[model samples]
Target: MGRHSLPDQYGAGASDPRRRARRRTVAIATVLVLAVAGGTAAAVRGGLLSFGSSCQDDPVRLTLAASPDLAPALESAAKRAREADLTSDGRCVAVTVSAREPYKVTDTLLAGKDPGAEVWVPDSEVWLQRLTATGGTADVSTVGHVASTPVGVAMEPTVAKSLGWPEKTYGWLELAGAALRDNSLRLGAADPARSATGLLALTRLSTAAAGVEGGDTQAAAMMKALSQRISDSDGQVLDTLPRDSSGTEQGNPRRNQALVVSEQAAYAYNTAADGDRSLDFFYPKDGSPRLDYPYALLEQTGLTTDQSRAAIRFMSYLDDPPQRRLLERHGFRTSDDEVPDALVAGAGGSGPQPYAEPAARPASAVALQETLGVWTITVQSARITTVVDASASMSEPVPGSGRSRMDVTKAALQRALATFTAEDEIGLWDFSTKLDGAKDYRVLVPTERLGDRKGTGTQRDRLSAAFGDLAPVPNGATGLYDTTLAAYRAATGSYAEGKFNALVILTDGRNEDPGSVSRADLVAQLERLTNPERPVPLIMIAVGPDADREEANRIAEATGGSGHEVSDPSQIQSVILKAIVEAASRDGQG
Candidate 1:
């Protein structure tokens, strides 16, 4: 049939009572089905689907496009649905799970436009609004609350005590003041634009600061402060929060993703992290926005018989008592039906939760709103950049270094990539020995390639693999000058649009033959890039006994970036992420 032709339910001759009653639904479904059929047929015609099964699967496959942040909860929900035999409801329901970065999942689902997958569960409701604003066609009525948690600082218990935890209601003022007072105080949070939790955290802070809770002004101010803080730190604090705070019993979180994430993520980490129960929660005194993850069925897309049944069944299972109990066991808040003692003990509920009605009256929305407004004005941004050192100093192990510079670089790079998000892109390149016969240079992936695709998870996977493949390759002298130039060119290439770029350079020592570009010449180029018209930020990182610290400073000064020196290789990753977070703001790429 042609694309415009309606489905069987909307056929002109159809006059059945059931069909008429569901006319609007049938019309919407017909449109979605035809679109899918057309796309699938086209894909098959072009050999994109690869198999005929894409067309044959009309029996109905329920695809679930969800945020990676919610993987733990929803996966549990799917398991429950399957155990209950929801798949046998004559619809041949199948749940296909696809993971995306938190802020991007909604965009991904809309792209597919299949509507065949009756349900989509994102990490936050704010993102759902973003999707809808972008012309979401689905019936939003199906959207319902599924799971939620508040944003809190996941810290080592010792760290919490040092920061004056439960005894004094740890709030943003204390947290920020402590970090400012003590250089050793490490703090972490997610990138606001990248994940709901991060955005919510920013919102909470903004609301508290501006005295305008949950408003755009608060969001803007929070973005500004967040940008400044991120600009200062460069981006290290957020990178190590999860792993450093995780409980050891659950296997260590793979170094393939960022550390500071949602409460659910923190829970997963603590569950897997094998260490002292030293980890604990630190809620901001202002009362941050709770991470409210919702599951909504898209009415715009017509679900296959199986998908329709599966979606409803899954929702019911989520609200069921047994499933709620399972969620509670995993360190999440138990349901109102039954709060497990184990969960209560683990959660350490010192205050009222948003889910259950409190024995005492809950805090007023006006009070909470006022606090959020204040937070928004005071929020700080987190900025970060990953720099790799590929100079000659890296070829050999230091006499007292214990490990080769190259080895340290690879390990640090791997750790650094794991701490970044689609929102944070690190410029990558390396300098090597240059023989008269050949050019000594290597640039892995440039900064622009990071998170280029709006909703695809490819960038994350690509970065993970690249970091995985990095190893000590001894070859040439350091080309810090030339590579920095390349990075500068990439970051500042489009200055007219008013972009904030940070150049993070990893170097073992001073620049050798700069490939015709003298040190002075390179500095001038950096100056041009950092011009107020362009404003390219710089962060220079060095590791080597004889490293040229002076040169690092000069490079950073040229671009208005910072220079950091670290002797301990183990701490480099956190330092970089924290530094970046301090430097970048919510206005910039948090």
Candidate 2:
């Protein structure tokens, strides 16, 4: 789709020929008036407009979509440019600036939908990175940066004091721990998938939780704990904070202590406060993500000669000294690293101290993609039934671990359980020849809330106990086909709403049951039963060197799921996490 082409939802009314003709007539009249005033000739003599460019009688019209937070400033600049009679080759340049969410635009572009904007000024370059990584059609080129804001935590003054604020150095882990330990400290962030600040916050929080070296189980648990507090937007998150006493309320039960937001947003909130209930900024010691408002030109939109020149001229106008100062008034630091003293003080920084910049560099494309995937799993609750193979081969000793395959697998399952939040539902099942009367699979625990149970400890304890109790049935054969079909049927029948439902099968051998249905029939049945709207990804983890990877992959493909093979049983937990992330990506949830 062309850059100017609106999505189907917006219809073709805006692109109607009559509308274009009207716009052209108005533009031509405006240019003629500007030329009569001598502004066009003076600008041309000043070398502001390229001499060789087309000199159409009509002014060029360009559309610019900017992040909501930055749109107001950009619109002001665009208006000023039009009033100043900014032109390319004597033809006046007019720009229309509109507010748009970077994530939504990126999604639309990646889906092969037209964004209807010649330029995009997103809050950060992250959106551009994501677009390129996801195979967007737009050939984007960054013209320059307009403003910058770093991601930081906004806390009520009293809360900051309690946490040792400016006097103490804290990173993401410390902040996350405080929230998890104190029930009253309700930490909130925007949905990571849609907000750059939220996404950066999550990336930092997850990295901190996992530790620099990765695979920190306790940290992963903390990350999941943090996800439960996510809000829909920065504004909604700020609303949870306490307001000043001019009849304004402070934070209530749902929102209390801290929020993840951009530095500019925090400044805006503090400046609007009527009392001492202002929010203080806390830049993470480890590093924060900085949002550099990048001005990108959509080159693939097939811009007309006049439109292209108009876009260039307007971009130059926005970067002028006067326009930069205007942007500073709106709480953004200029591209030249210039921040006003008054703005700094308003955001809670004093004379000798300035708001801290991001300590860590921006994430690589691959890292950002992985972080988003992990965030999806953290937010979307899952209903999973773990089916373990307890056939005779499970008792064989693993090569390097010096432990039986079953023993290692059980240990990995126990570790994996810790990564899930309480909101997630899980169950346990075991499969072997004739395990339940003539059946190959039997339920060890019924699916229920991770935090729900009849007895003292949580459901996790019950699951761990079940895994520990699994023992290989001597002389038993693998009942892969029938057990898988039955499990899939059970999962589909009991599918929960607003949750990812799946049956995770871990096996060390191929199907060996003669009484089972044929492999082709099983694949066909699974394909026929699959539903895109109500998806239940069948994840098959082939364990040990002897496992059949090909058959496992076949089953997963038929059900819109995934398959993974692990030769080292000790790596099972990590592999399981990877599988879950991959499944989430396949379902387009991340």
- Worst 10-residue stretch by lDDT in candidate 2? 1-10
Tell me the tens digit of each residue's lDDT in model 1 across 341-432. Answer: 44433433234332133221223333232323223223421122345765555667755758776676677676445433344445455556
Rate residue 94 of model 1 by lDDT: 45
How many residue pairs clash (N, CA or C atoms closer than 3 angstroms) in each of the candidate models, in the order given? 81, 3
**Full-model lDDT for every candidate:** 0.52, 0.76
> For model 2, how does the per-residue alpha-carbon lDDT over 1-590 read when each residue is reduced to its tens digit?
00232233223122245754884687677667868888888766776444455333466788899998899888998787666556665566778898998977887777676789988899888889877755457678886777787787877777777878777767877877777776767788887777888878777776676655434445656657667777776667777665544425544566567888887887787777764767777777788777888878887777776676667666666656788788878888774344577776677654322354533777766556656755665578789999999999999999978999999998888767766767789999999889999999999999988878676878877887888898998998899999999999998889999987788999999999999999999999998888888888899989988898888998988988878888977767766665675577558743
TM-scores, all candidates, are 0.45, 0.71
